[model samples]
Target: MSTVKMISLRVKSMKNIQKIVKTMKVVSAAKYAKAKKDLLVARPYGTSTKVFYDKLDLKDPQEQTLLIAITSDRGLCGALHKNVSTKIKEEFAKRPENSKIVCVGEKSRGLLQGQYGKSFLGVADQIGRKPPTFLDASRISNILFTTPYKYTSGKIIFNESKSVVSYLTSVVSVFTLRTLNAAPGLRVYDSLDDDLLQSYLEFSVTSLVFYALKEAAASEQSSRVNAMDQASKTAGNMISELTMVLNKTRQAAITTELIEIISGATAAKKDSGV
Candidate 1:
């Protein structure tokens, strides 16, 4: 009986968990759809900017390097955050002394806190609670501009959404205003002024950040949806298995009770000579 009760309890608990997992899957699916739509709309801006920057033929700067990791505070989203953090860790390993990290989300900070705490320049939290906006990107870009630690060349690490169930960890190049000004291809532009270039740099940063945020957001949602779906399926299987066990145990218990009752009645009848 105790075994039967335990199995029954397990089945009930698993059913409840499955319900939560299904609910989470539904919510993540909705968010993924929106994120994917937004990413499609924003792709052009990021691509065009990247193409224009590439045409400048900018030389990789030899000075301090910056790394901006785009992640979220939330977990249970598969390897979305881990992918970005792992890439950043590789970069940091290469240049531990010169690399500085600007974590666009708290997850990166948390992941890299122990070993590379000193390398973190700033962190932006409360990300992914809502869809990322241009304002959010602008705020993150401002951290780069206002921070005392300056960097000449950098990379933005993020997870790029490929499909409903897949993503690619990608890196985008970044250059400081000074480095951009010194690009060999800058000679092609006849009369670009300092103020104009500064504005362009600021805009570029914001655009890049915006693009990364959208990609990361979409990837996170998709990963989360898939994760929850898997969890729900596993929970469902466990519930079914446990329920089966409970039924078998219950049947055995009933069989034993009936057998005992039959034996007692037969003994009484025999003793009474009936």
Candidate 2:
């Protein structure tokens, strides 16, 4: 009886847990859809900006490099932050000793802070609490720009969404000081004066940052949904197993009672006959 009761309780608890996990899976799926939509909306502009940067030939002293890693504020997604953190550290390791760390979201901040100490320059949390926006990305880029460090170039590490439910670790380049801005004759278009060029440069940075943040959010949601689905399945399997056990125990108890009753009746009849 105790075993049956214990199993029953366990199954009940697991059912409750399964419900929660299933709900989360649904919620994350919804969020992922929204995030993916936003990312798709903004990706083209970011891609164009990246192409523009690639065409520019600017090589500063490489004196100060920045490593911006996009992670998440919360964690339920498996190895999402850890994979990005590992990529960040690997990039940081390959850079010049003067490189600084910039983390987007809390997870990367925590993971890199202890390792990099003061080298970790800036960390932006709550960036992923809502679906990413152009304004949010702009604000983050502006914050990085305002930093006292004179970084010539930057590398952004993020998980790029490869498919609806898959992501791959990727890096985006930032030529903070574009050579075209400084040279009037070499400017691709005469309409872009120094101020206009600067503004466009900032926009480029923002766009890139925006892309990274949005994609990371999508990937994070995908991972969360996948994890929750697995959890729900496990819970369901446990419940089914326990239910089977309970049913078998119940059958055994019924069989035992029938045997006892039949034995008692048979002994009474035999004594009557005697």
Candidate 3:
């Protein structure tokens, strides 16, 4: 019933809230650590696949360019999904107007749907939590091969700039496939033997699909790690704020009790004629 008691209750509530936030922060940090590790392990494989694809001289104009846009199914990862979506959009902008987009995550699908509409081929959910197995890779590869992308031949375009390629190569040389032959109007299918060309096309398409999945997995993990880190930081801040509030409430209660004591003493003195 007392003001002090009410204030104490509030302090207790704040402390409880602070405890929850602290726990959440710890959990997020642990998840982030695991995600970071996953990303590191998969980095090399993704890079090598990309490098191998770059070496093939596919210069045919009639070839359909398939853009496998990778992103997270969820959105708690800071600007990771946004950044990827932006990168995809920029890549799309550079294309010759009829590029096909195959999204790997729900986030990517949702973001690109309004813009690309029917051009969006399909979506794969939860592609980031686990390391992509060959089965997973095969599913994506099959999708690419069976889809209209193969039937419609064109140049394959990567969104990354030259600087990015250079940076990646310098850091992870083994993963770097090779310098991409960016020569415009270069014909690709001409150099291959008939059966080899078909095989190469199939392999190339599969490789691209595999690379995309790998990259998507890496990116998603990285994004989640970053998100968890930020969540941890935000939780820390909330705890701090709650602590301050608890302190303030405690102080207010203490001041109220002192005031009541002083008032009682004054009343006694007046009644005693002192």
Q: Which runs of model 2 end up more than 4 angstroms from their true locations? A: 57-61, 178-196, 248-274
For candidate 2, the per-residue lDDT at 134 reads 79
How high is the CA lDDT of each candidate model? 0.90, 0.82, 0.54
Q: How many clashes in each structure?
A: 0, 0, 12
Two-way TM-score contest, 1 vs 2, winner? 1
Would you estimate the TM-scores of all the predictions?
Answer: 0.95, 0.83, 0.67
Residue-level lDDT tens digits of model 2 in 165-250: 57898998775655445433446655656677777778788889988888888899998988898898898898898899989987
Q: Please, what are the lDDT tens digits per residue for candidate 3 over residues 130-159?
A: 565566666665666566444344222222
Full ranking by lDDT? 1, 2, 3
* Distance from true location, Cα of 55 in model 3, Å: 3.8
**Ten contiguous residues minimizing lDDT sum, candidate 1:** 1-10
On lDDT, the stronger of 1 and 3 is 1
lDDT of 1 at 74: 85
